[model samples]
Structure formats: structure tokens, C-alpha cells
Target chain A: MSNLEQIAKLSGFSKATVSRVLNQSRHVSQPTRDKILAIMEELDYVPNGNAISLSKGQTMQIGMVTEGINEVMLPFLNSFVETASQYGYQTIIYTSSGDPKKELQAFEDMRRKRVDALVISTCVNDLALLGSYCKYGPIVSWQRMENPQIASVAMNQYDGYTLGLEHVISRGRTRIANAYGRPSSINTLGRIEAYEDAARRHGLAELPQWSRTGIHSIRQGEELVREMLAVEDPLQRPDAVLCSNDLVAAGIVSEARRRRLRVPEDLAVVGFDNTELAHTLGITSIYNPIADQAKNAFHLLLAKLGGACEPQQKLQYCLVQRATT
Target chain B: MSNLEQIAKLSGFSKATVSRVLNQSRHVSQPTRDKILAIMEELDYVPNGNAISLSKGQTMQIGMVTEGINEVMLPFLNSFVETASQYGYQTIIYTSSGDPKKELQAFEDMRRKRVDALVISTCVNDLALLGSYCKYGPIVSWQRMENPQIASVAMNQYDGYTLGLEHVISRGRTRIANAYGRPSSINTLGRIEAYEDAARRHGLAELPQWSRTGIHSIRQGEELVREMLAVEDPLQRPDAVLCSNDLVAAGIVSEARRRRLRVPEDLAVVGFDNTELAHTLGITSIYNPIADQAKNAFHLLLAKLGGACEPQQKLQYCLVQRATT
Candidate 1:
């Protein structure tokens, strides 16, 4: 007889009772459970994978963790949701609020929900903890991290910035301005690095007064420009600006108009994300293939969950020049 | 003894095998399965709800269906995701490209995946079809429909336009233009009705040239204006514009600058959705309290799924005037 049958007989109970106990059923009395568990332990009984899967069937779910879906995330999210469903998997969303404790809690909740995998975006902190979650299941991110277990689909944001910088510099924009979301974030740091590299290469001086950080919204983007305009020194001001997002770029453009600063002639500008606002306003901006990124991320998670691991995916990006440059 | 016990004894099999057969296990022989099923039918054995929930335990997953997320849905989506998670439920996103067959297919798929509930946004054509899906589980929408089975949290989008109309009219503007996503959509119709009402009350002429349909984007907003500008009759052109969305409003502002039209002086403009772009561009717009709408929709779904049905919620709106008006 098999170990299960032996345990059933030894415990003076049916196989159903032993099975229920293994599945962690509360109906089984403490004495009966203890007796059956001891017998199973003595026999070195291990529950089969089929039994576990039968109890916890395919949820066909992929959980998404993000730092609360913001403007740049919205379009990407729409594409991700559509693309993920197309892949025969349902997509679940969890907002982590970028808090370490809250992020870990969200991860734990996703695990308990038996999500097939997780796709995270812009993890400002708690990356190590997030990386540790890969052992539990497939984990993919928007960052191109070095870890092999955790896969990612990332845009060439840094290189895209360089292209933008070169375009603006070529336009004779010597005093360049820029903005950042979280100055400390790896994404922001990398972008800042590329800007510095491009500036040094082009022999353009980096003015501290021109760059701003901690800008979170379009209003702030306008305020950032207003602050730039407030400075008394004519030579200290930026001849052109590059924004972290299109919303901010739109804000800067609006504010520039309010001050009667002619675009391109008075001050050239560029925006990132290539959102609808960019196309509408005719602003030069970086176009990250958001839909492609979503598709790649979904496929990456699908591959990892299917037990075929792939390396980190780096998606392409470009500067879409309109009238702003 | 219970029917299950009687069926097991009559089949001359252990309860485990009988239970497995009922749960659709392939381990049992055909003869055994037929015999056991026959016994079960004869005994009228009914499986309890706990058994089903155990098999498809609270995936805690709520599938969301939308007619493809767009610019207007972004703020609502962000809040919906955050609010749903706050109420101890995870959110799943499914984008139906507004295709009737595709939407129904998505619904059936979500049902197969055993999502606890579904929340839909802007069902333009497939509403009745979507309404029929309430029988499977709880269905909530971003519309306050007459169907009770499909609970909703809707915005007063009609009143929002009226408010916009009144604000601009109060500011001594008579020739007003408006645009929409799908001109025939219920949302657009309601807004149009309010616009008509407000126009009559204000004794303003309804120039057919001023009200354009099928304005899908900001570029379209500008195109609408350019089309207005093309009209040889100066009397037919609008003195102010009321846009379907803030992106469109921003576009009008951009286009106005291109034509050297001073806003609120030459052509005042108002927008809906009150997005960051609206505030950035200093456009007068309608604020729909999207976060509140999202929270109410989530709670309504929560109540219905938790076995207590709640009435549909109608969220209010307001006109926020800025430099543009």
C-alpha cells in the first residue's frame, strides 16, 4: 500500500480524513489531525503537486504593483491591461504608494491571492525586498535590474534624453534646463547622468539654477519655469528646457506663453512620454513605445511563468520632433 | 446519515473517491464514475456552497472592463485602483476595444476565471449585453443606469456642461462651441441636451457650425477651431469653445495662440475632466470629483458582492474658472 493508505489505516481513519488534514481543513479535530499528521510524518508522506493545483487552480491572473498610477502611467496602463488580456491572462492592479511596508504588504496580499505573477513599475524603494519576491513566482519590472530571476522591460530613457539634449544643443540652446520627479530614484539619476554627459560632450555649462527636482505635477512644471523666470540674472536663465514628462512640458509651454516667451525662438523646450498633450501642443518630446513595453513585459512574465526564463528586455525610444524644437 | 454518506456507502467506495468524482477527478474509472453519479442523483445529494468556495476561494480579484482606457478615464482609473485596494479587494483590468462581441467574450472569460466581480466603464453600444452579465456575479459601472442588478457610480456630466455654459454665458459669451467623443453616446447626448437647455435659457443662437461631433482628440479640437476659422461667415464662428476634455481645451488654447487669438478676450474656452493639463493651461473646466466617484463605485460593488445591495450613486460636478475664461 502507498504511504497515504498506510497512514489512513494506522490513524484508524479513512483516506478522506487524512486528505482533509493535509489540505489544512479545520473540520478535522485536533486529536485526529495530530494522530494523522504524526503517521504521515513517520511515513515521510509528501502531498503531490496535482493535489495542490486541484485545490488552487489557475487564477489566470497577473498582479501589477505601481507607485499609484499617475499621468505617465495611465496610457501605459491602458495598453498593458489590453495587451495582458490578449495574452489570455487577467491583470490585477495593486497600488503600493511607494511605501516599503505598504509595498511588502501588497506583495504578500498578491501572493495570498495566488496571482500567476507580478509586474512592478518604478519601485522608488524596497527593491531588494521586491527582488526577494521572485522566488515565490515570476516578477517583472519597468527597471532593467541586474538580477537574473527578476525580469524587466525598460525604455531606453537615458539614451532618449541624450538625443533630446543633442537636438536642443544643435539648435544653439547653450543654457539648458531640466526637471526630475524623485531626484534620488535610479531612473532620475540615470537621466541626470545622461544630461551631464551630453552637456559635457557638447561643451555646454551646467547651471544649477536651470535644473529643478521634486517636481510632481503640471502645476509644478509651470512653477519651475516661473521660478526660472524670477531669477534676475539674464545669463543664468535657460535658453531651452527639457521636462521629465509631457504634462510638465505642456505646463512650461503654457507658462512660457503667459510670459510672452516665444517657443523655439525665445526658449526651446522638449518633453518626455510623448503623451497626447505633446502631439496636441506640437512639442518636441521623447516617444517611448509604451504599448511595445507592455507587450514585452507581459510576454516576459508569461515566459517566466511558463518556466522559460528570458533576459531583461530593453525597448527602444526616440525623440519625436514637432514645432517646439 | 446524510445523502453524501448514503451515496458513498451505496457505491461501495470510500468517501474520498466519491468526493473526488463529484469534484470531477479523472482518477476514478468510467464504470465507477457512472455508478457513483447514478447513486448521487438517486439520493438527491446536493453539494454545499463551502465546497465550491474552497475550490474557487476568494481570488479576491475584481475584473474591470472598460471601452479601452483613454485620456478621460486616467484619473478615474488611478483612484479606482487605489480605492478598490483600500477596500480589501484587488482590481483586475480588462480593456474591451468597444467591440460588442469582444466585450461579451471578455465577460465570459472573467466568469471562467472566477473573478468575484466586474466594474465597467463607458459601455456605449453593448450596455444591454453588458447588463445581461449581472447574473454571473456583481457588475458595477461608471454610469448610473436604470438597472439595479448592475450598480453604478456616475458623474453628472450633463450638468457639468450646463455649468460650463452658464459660466461662459455669464461672462458675456454667446457664440459657444462644444465637442464630444462619440456624439451619439448617452453621455454626449445628456451634455448636448443640457447645452441646448442652457442655450435657450440664455437666449443664445445655436449655430450648427459651432457644435461639432466626432472630436476624438486635442488635434481634433484644434482642427474643429481651424474649421471654424475657415468659415467665411464671421457671424457663424464661435466666440468661445467648450471642449469634451481638458486635452482638447489645451489644444484649443494652443491653436488659438497659433492664430493670435487671445483667450477670454477674442475666444474664451472651457474644458471638462479638470485634469492637470487644465490647471496647467489655466483653462476654465469642470471638476467631476473623480476620486469620490471611484470610491463610491468601489464601495457599491463591495456592498453588492458582500450580499447587501446599495442604490446607484450620482456624483456632482462644478465649474472651475481660471485665466482662460
Candidate 2:
């Protein structure tokens, strides 16, 4: 006889009664169920419950590994959580601030905790570590990685920047510069590539001094613009500036205004994200469809975990024209 | 004989090996473990493993129920998750958009899943429903509630607004108006009370047209400011506009600037949140101590869960004066 049968007989209960208690059914009397649970607890009979549950399939749990703090983090997480809830799945969130060591630990913990899948939202340079974690479960990345094993939802940041730059160039401005966070980040690198392409296409000379990188805050934007404006050379001045975000663009606008330069007419500016601030300030911006990206990422992960291997997705972005451009 | 004896005897091995396999111990050989697991699976012996595990204690899981989308959600979640991780706990998030039924479901789900604790970040008017869930686990709220049973990390929004409004009044601006989110929300109500107190104390006649309600976006700010400026009565015109957030202030600033009105000189504007945009645009605003609130909320919840009773906490906010005011 099996261990379950032994427990049933020892408890003086039928196998169905024991099973009902195990399943946490409400039909069983409280005292009888409590006595059975006490006996089972004493025996230490269910130590491998999590593993057994995983083998039985469908924990209804999705793991999300994110950097946890970003402009996109809350919106993406909101969309993902709502969408996951619609599919009767609960989401477990882990944030490591892009730390690979912590990310590995998160993967290990998620595996031990028996999550069905993982969505990696943070920008990670380490591909091997991410690939190794695939052994634990289905892994989906927010960025488009060309890897066949890992699925991705790619953001069309390159084309978006290209379009923004083209808009600036078409408006008869030749001297252009870009400032953004972390030149090493993949998105920034893509933007840089697009910036170079636009400069080359428009026959605008790329000023080494004009290309400002490692700019993260509005204060940085003010400092950078002031530094550029302090340039004594007239020919070296950028006629137009493309900022990493609305805040940076706002800083540039304020500083330029302080110098009595009219926006668009004197120093044209374009910002990214098309945030509420961008719209309010009438800033030309690139709109990354955060909600769409979130939905697609969740669906792709869900489909993969549900036995259908969905292809990697690439979402589109739009350039919104406003007063600044 | 018990099921343990039956399984051990049936496998021609000792109960210790059987127990090791059930515990997922690496000490047992792969083949032995696999054979024992197969037999257990066939017999449906591990069905009550989850219940047994719960009784054994410490699932290391904490459930967070939020409204999912808010300016504060991402930043708050970042702090909560990091703090939870420090305590060796994993967070499962549920967002119901303030739906009480779904929140009730979340509580039930958390209880059924055997989560050790719960954190409620969503705003709910009903205290009775929340009180009912206290039996499931230790519960902590993110808002200031009068319930002695529920510990909260309260935000001093009332005093924060009073301080902001008083600053505007001190700057010799008589025609003061307020703009904010849903009037029904507790935060906005507090702000309204402060607005009234400021207007009454300063002996400024309340202009019906000056008070704008249900303003949520930058566009709304622009529209409302435009509407205010269009008012024919000179006595009703607001000289200063206090916005719900930096985004709104940006909108008011942009609209005012569009009509050649100099900020602070002609029209004073103050925004709340002191977000990056506010700094970039040089808007005077109130800074909500997000990180401090997050830390305190986590510590409050942690203390309650750790069997140490912590009193309800109220974090302070400060007004940051910049160029716009």
C-alpha cells in the first residue's frame, strides 16, 4: 500500500476524506480535518509540495525581473499585472537595479519558488547568464535580443530617433546635437547610431563637442547647455538639440529662454517619451507605446508558457510634432 | 502501519530514504529519488503536500495589493520590493484598480496561498472588509486610517498643502486658485480643506471660477488656465495657480507663456511633487518624500509581521521653492 493509504487508515478516515483535507476543501468537519492535518504534520509527509505542484503543472504564477525604477517601470508593471490577472495568473516581482548577480539570485529564487515564467525588463549586457537561467523556465526579455532561445518584445527606438532627427533637419536646421543617459545603454547606442545616420544623410558635420553623453537629470541638461552656449565659436553652436527625455528638453528650453532665445525659432528642441510634461510644454517628442509593449510582452510570455511558441515582437513608435520642433 | 512505513516497505528501503526523497534531498541517488517520486505520483500520495507545507510554516511570500497605475506606484513598489527582499521575502503583486470585489478575491487568494503577510497600497473606503481579512495574516495599509487594528504609514498631505498655499499667500498673491485630482479622494479632500483655510485666513474672497476640480492632466491645466484667463470679471481672475502636480504647473506655465504673461511677475504658479520636470522648468513645488514613505511603510509592515507591534507612522513633506513661485 502507498503512504497515502497508510495515512488514511491511521487517521480512521476514507481516502476521499484525506484527499479533501489535503485539497483544503470546506466539506470536511473542522475537528476531523485538524486532527488529520496534525497527524500529517507530525509525519512530515508533504515536504516536496512545491516540486510536486510544479510537476503537476500550472502554478498560475508569473515572475517578473525588473530594474524596478524607471519611467517605463510602473506603466509596464501596471499593464503586465492587469493583463496577467485577466489570465488568472498572479505576478511575483523582483527588482535588482540591473545587477546581474542579484538577477541570478532572483532566477534561482523564482525557480525554487516555482514560477511558470520570467519577464526580464532591465537592460542586461550579460547574455550568457540570462541564457543559463532558461533552464529554470521560459524567459522573455523586454528588449529584442536576436537570440533564438529567448523571446523578446523589441522597441523601435532607432527608427523613432531617426524620424525625430529627420523632422529637425527638414525644418532647415543643420547644426544638431543629442544628449542622453549612459552612452553604453543599448537604447542610447541605437539613438547614437540613428543620430550619426541622420547627420551623415543631412550633410551636417558632427561636432565632437556637441555630442553630450552621460546626461541624466535636468540639472545636467542645464549644465550641458550652458557649457555648449559658453562656446565662443559661432560655427560650432548646435542650432537644434535632441534631448533624451521631456525633463531634459524642459531644462534646455528654460535655459535658452533665460538667454532670450525663442524656442523652435532660435534653438529647436525635441524630447522623447511624449510624457504629460512634453505635451504640456508643447515639446516635439517620440512616443514609445508603453502600453502596447507591456501587453505584447505579457502575451508573448503567456503564450510560450501555455505551450504555443510565439514569435518575438517588435512594436512601433511615433514622432509627435509640437511647437518646439 | 502509516503511509510512511507502507511506502518504505513497498520500496524495500528505510523511511529515512523515502523521507529524503520527499524532502527533495540531494543525498538520495537520482534513480532512487526518481523511482520513489514516480511511485508517489502514481499513488497520488503528495496531493496534500501543500497543506502539510503550510502547516510546517514560513512560505516566505508576501502579497502586495495595489491599484496598479499611479505616479507613486513604481517608486513605491521599488522601495517595498527591495525592503522585502532584504528580509528574505518574495512579493506577489495584485492590482485591482480599487475594485473592492477583486480586492476581496485577492485577500482570499493570499490566504489560500498561505502568504505570511499583506500590504495594501490601494485606496478603499470600506474598513470592515479590510478588518475581516486581518485573520488571514498581518495587514498593513499605506494610507492614514483611524483603525487601531491597521497600522499605516500616513502622508501629511494636509499640512503639506497648507504650507504650499501659505507660501503663495505670503508672496502677496491674493487671487489664489487650486487644481487637483478627484475631489472624492482623501488626499484631495485634505488639500481642499487647506485651500479653504488659507483663503479664509487671508480674507481673500473665494472666487468660484478660481477653484478647478477633477483636473488630472497637463492638457486640463492648460484648458483650465485658459478658461480662467478668459473670465471677463477682473475681480475673479486668479493671480496665482496652485497645481496638483508638476505636470499641471508645466501646462499652466506653457499656457501663460503662450499669451506673453511672465511667470511670477504677472502670474505665480506652484506645482506639487517637485518632480524632475519641475526642477527642469524651475517651478516651485511641494516635495512628497516618496522614499521615506516607502521605507516607513515597509518597516511598519515588517514590524507587525515580526510580532513586534509598531504604531501608525506619519511622514512629513516639505515645500521646495523655485523660480515659478
Candidate 3:
């Protein structure tokens, strides 16, 4: 049978009634609606939702901005996109590459694309440039500092670092070294403060030589370890090393092995952001609760979209101890 | 001066001309254009690119589909998004979660959103569902089998495995153990075939008892290693183990350590997909060029979008020998 004949016979309705239901031009009786729905389902008819939405002047799409994609943030990005998909909103991802100009451009592009909302995890320190874009739509920042102008979902970095330091102190490590991320970043700064404060509270002087700052990469960790090992005095060598993240800590452990030093026995190591690498390496580290952070970021963005008041959301962190400490 | 007055005075042109140039409405002379550009640059004016694009009926958005986000694929995702941004396109990512249903859904959503192009690294074996989406715009698959109906870019997995397996065989290990991925996966199947063929060619019978299949996770690796060690006789146990990926290799090492087995001394271990974990663990593994694969996928997608002839792009892989093997 032809398509129209099949629809009419299946619905037990006239062609005019079927057409009206198909086009939604007029209201139909409940019995007629039920019959038409069953017929459509039986025929495996797939309606084009986009076409209907377009006819009604609506498009569902969102934008997500992130820092340089790498192991550090891949899981989070994946989760965010998947969750956004559940809400019938498509997500556009922009990589800022830790550049301010690129971040500004990304926001501008999202605005141009007319995305309903945006989730940003860029590296720019200031939020002033993002004000105009935020005004255009709901803007949410993830795993970063709280912005008064935009809702933010961030992990408690200070507490996470403190927990790591406290774990090391619990292990009776007196002299400690730290391989931290860039000091310019707010998250890194929080870690540095926590380290100093925790050390001072434990009755140890925070030595300047024991701290090194660099990008969060294995090569940086290896370089920092080499620098530390080059110190001639035995007393100058730290008994433990704390890394900004698990990846860096793994690098430090590898470098130590190359230098013929043993882990936990010769020098205890601790890291932050308990990523999969840390779990595999059996390194003691802080769990940053990335999945929770992503969920909170989504909710915060949703709230802003619903015209709710914007508030800073800080997720909790925990210490996960392994053989390294 | 106010914004309008500043634009009029700085360009030394009529207000209408400045407005036209800002809106990109009418063709202005080159000298006038240069003067207006300089004036805008001097005034620190940031043009609303999105607003201008809207007037021109351009969306400037693209979509990407991939398996669950993890550390291994993060670098590639970052680079793809960064490059897309350079080309004035915003990218939306969809996670397939290795489910064919979700992969199909992501394609449908991308089509509904009218994405300019799509880049997918799906886990599904068939491309029939993807064919329908390709009709609307370009759809590029990454690290998957290619179909004449869809464009694809993938690594030379067979060659990479052969290289690593040959290295292990050359080391005089006859009893080889293999930790493979799911048998249903094409990539894993290729690696398994290469390994079995290499063994047969070397005059060794492929032992079913020496092979294990599981997902790519550290826990799986550890479990597989334990099962291998549980063999009744130590002499009958395999002398070497080849892992499907780095995470699995790390798990094997951890399990070996738990069983008081020294790597390369008691049982040599090798891994595929030389990720950062492999480097830090000093495990000999195959290096799959993720960046190049991503770049090639983007180029192929662009070509398909431009209605160019579709070509299957296969990238090369290498084997890096480290201390483990």
C-alpha cells in the first residue's frame, strides 16, 4: 500500500484526519491521537525533531570551553559532553590552549553560534573579558576559581593539598620537597600556600630550595628531581617529595629509580589529583573528585539558564594513600 | 567620546560607512578598509564575530564523536579542538561510551544540530548507521575500519604489533603470553592475528591456554597476571607477556611485583599504544601516532565536506624498546 493509505487504514481515520495529525494543524480526538501514535510506531516512523523545533523558532545547543586537551582533563570533558547530551543539548568544545586571546575568541565564537549555554575551563586569570559573553548566555566555569560574574564549580584545592601534606607528616617525613605547577595559576597558588602552612604547623621551616615550579609534565618532574639530586650536602636532600599531580609524581618516581633510589624506602612521594596513572603507579595522592566537579558545573550552568541566582560551588576532595607515602 | 562618535571621528569616514564596515555589509575601498581597520585597532575594538556571522547565516560549529574520554585520547581531542578553533569552527564532542546505540544517537544529534562536519572514533564495528548521517555532511571515523560510504583515518595497528612481537621473539622467548583486548574489536583482533602469525612463523605453536581477553583497564591486567601465575607448574608458565595497551601492562607489572617476579628477569612484558604510563614504567610498547591520526581525520572530514573523493587514510606506528622487554 502507499504511505498515505497505510497511515489511514492503520489509524482507522480519513486521509484528512491523518494529514491534520501528521502536520499538527488542528486538534484531534484522544482516540484518533492514540490510533495515529500506534500507527506511526508500527511503521517505525522517525519524526525530525529539529524540523519541528525550527518551525517553532527553537534550537537546542550548548558550548563547552576547555584548556589544552590531555590526560589531565579528558575524562572530565567526556563526562560533561555525555551528560549534556542527555538534556537534548549538543555541546561545542573549544580548546583555549591556555591562551587568553584564544579563550576570548572561543567565547565570541560560541556567542556567534547562538549556543543556549556555555561551560568554560579556560586558563585565563581574569573574567572581565568574558563579561559581555556571559551576559549573552549562562556561563559556568569548571575546576577553577570562583567568579562573581559567572557561576563556578571548583574542587577544594587548598584542602586537597593539606590532606596530602598531612599524610606525609603522618608517615614521619620531616624534610620534604615539592614539585608544583605554575605559581601564577590560582589552583597552584592554593597548593603552595597549603604546603607552607602545613609545614609551618608541623614545626618545620619552609626552605626555598626545596620548592620548584614548572609545567605539569613528566619531563618537568624529571628535571626537578635531577636538580634536587645535584645538591652535594646529604642534609639538603629532602626525605619526601610532593608533586602537583599524579603524572608529575610518576615522573619523579621514574627519575629516582634511574638515579638508583628506592620509592617509599629512600624517598616517599605524594601527588595531587588522583588520576588513573596514580592508581596504577600505587602512588599516594589526593582525589580531586572530577566526576562530581563536572556534575556540579552542569547543574550550575543549568541553574543560570533557569534564571536562578548564581553561587560559587566548591566540591570536596579526599586523600588516597598508597605505597608511595 | 562615546562609542559611535569615536568610530566616526577615528576613521575620518561617514558614520554610515563605519557602520557598514563594522557590520561587514557593503564593499568598502581598500584604503577605506585599511583606515577603518587601523581605527578599530587603535580604539581596542573587539568585533562581535558571532553577531556578524549570524547576519551572514553561518553557524560556524562542528561536532565530534568518540569513545569514552580517557588519558590516552585526551591529547588528540585537545589538538583537534585547537585546530578547529583556528579554522573558525567551534567543536562539540559526543561520547559513545563504546555502545553502538549511543554512537547512532550521537550521529543523529549531530545531523539534527546541522553540524558542518563530524569526526568520530566510535567503537562500533559497522558503518551502516553512520552512512545515513554522512549524507547530510562529512563524517570522519578515527581508528576504525573504513567503508566506501564513510571517510576514515586509522593507525597501522597490524604493523605496530608485528614490530613489537618480532622484538620479543628475537629476544629468544619461546613461551609467550598474550593479554589481549575484547575479541570483537577490530583493533584487538588485528593485534592478536599479528601475534599468532609471528609465533607460528617462528615455529612455535599458538597455545590457547596462554592467552587472555579482557577490557583495557589496570584491574583487568592485574587479574590476568594473577591467573597466569596461578598455573600449576612454574616451568609451564609463559616466559613473556604482551599487553594490548599500557594500562594493562602496568597492571601486569604490579601483579608480577605482588607475586615476587622481576620484570624481564622472570617474565618479560610488552605493551601496545605507548602512552605516558609506558614511558614512565619503562615498558617496551608500540607507539600509535595519535596527533597525526587526529589531524588526518580532520583533513579527511574537510575533504568529504567539500565533496572531494573519499580516500582511506592509514597512519604508521612504531615500536619503542624500553627496559621492561
Please report the candidate that would top TM-score against the real structure: 3
How accurately is candidate 3 docked according to DockQ? Answer: 0.39
Candidate 3 chain A: worst-modelled 10 consecutive residues by lDDT? A49-58
Tens digit per residue, CA lDDT, model 3, A213-253: 87589877777778877888856788888888888888888
How would you order the candidates by lDDT, starting with the best?
A: 1, 2, 3
Provide the lDDT at A170 for model 1. Answer: 87
lDDT of 2 at B149: 75
Worst 10 residues of 1 chain B by lDDT: B46-55
Tens digit per residue, CA lDDT, model 2, B172-269: 99988889666666678788888888888889888666677788666887887678768787456788888887768878888888877678887789
> Model 1, stretches more than 4 Å misplaced?
A1-57, A307-315, B1-57, B146-148, B307-315
Q: Between which residue pairs do clashes occur in model 2?
A: A3-B3
Clashing pairs in 3: A92-B92, A93-B91, A112-B50
What's model 2's lDDT at A325? Answer: 76
- Provide the global lDDT of candidate 3 against the true structure: 0.74
Model 2 regions lying over 4 Å from their true place? A1-56, A259-261, A307-314, B1-56, B259-262, B307-314
lDDT per residue as tens, model 1, A1-325: 9657888899899989988898898999999999998987787565532234445654566777787777678766777777777766767777777666656755664454456688887665556767777765788887666566777677656887888899998888899888876776656777889889988898878987667787757788778777877878856778888888887888888888888778878788899889877877788999987777877888888776674445545567788999888
Please report how far candidate 2 places residue A34 from its true position, in Å: 21
Better of 2 and 3 by lDDT: 2
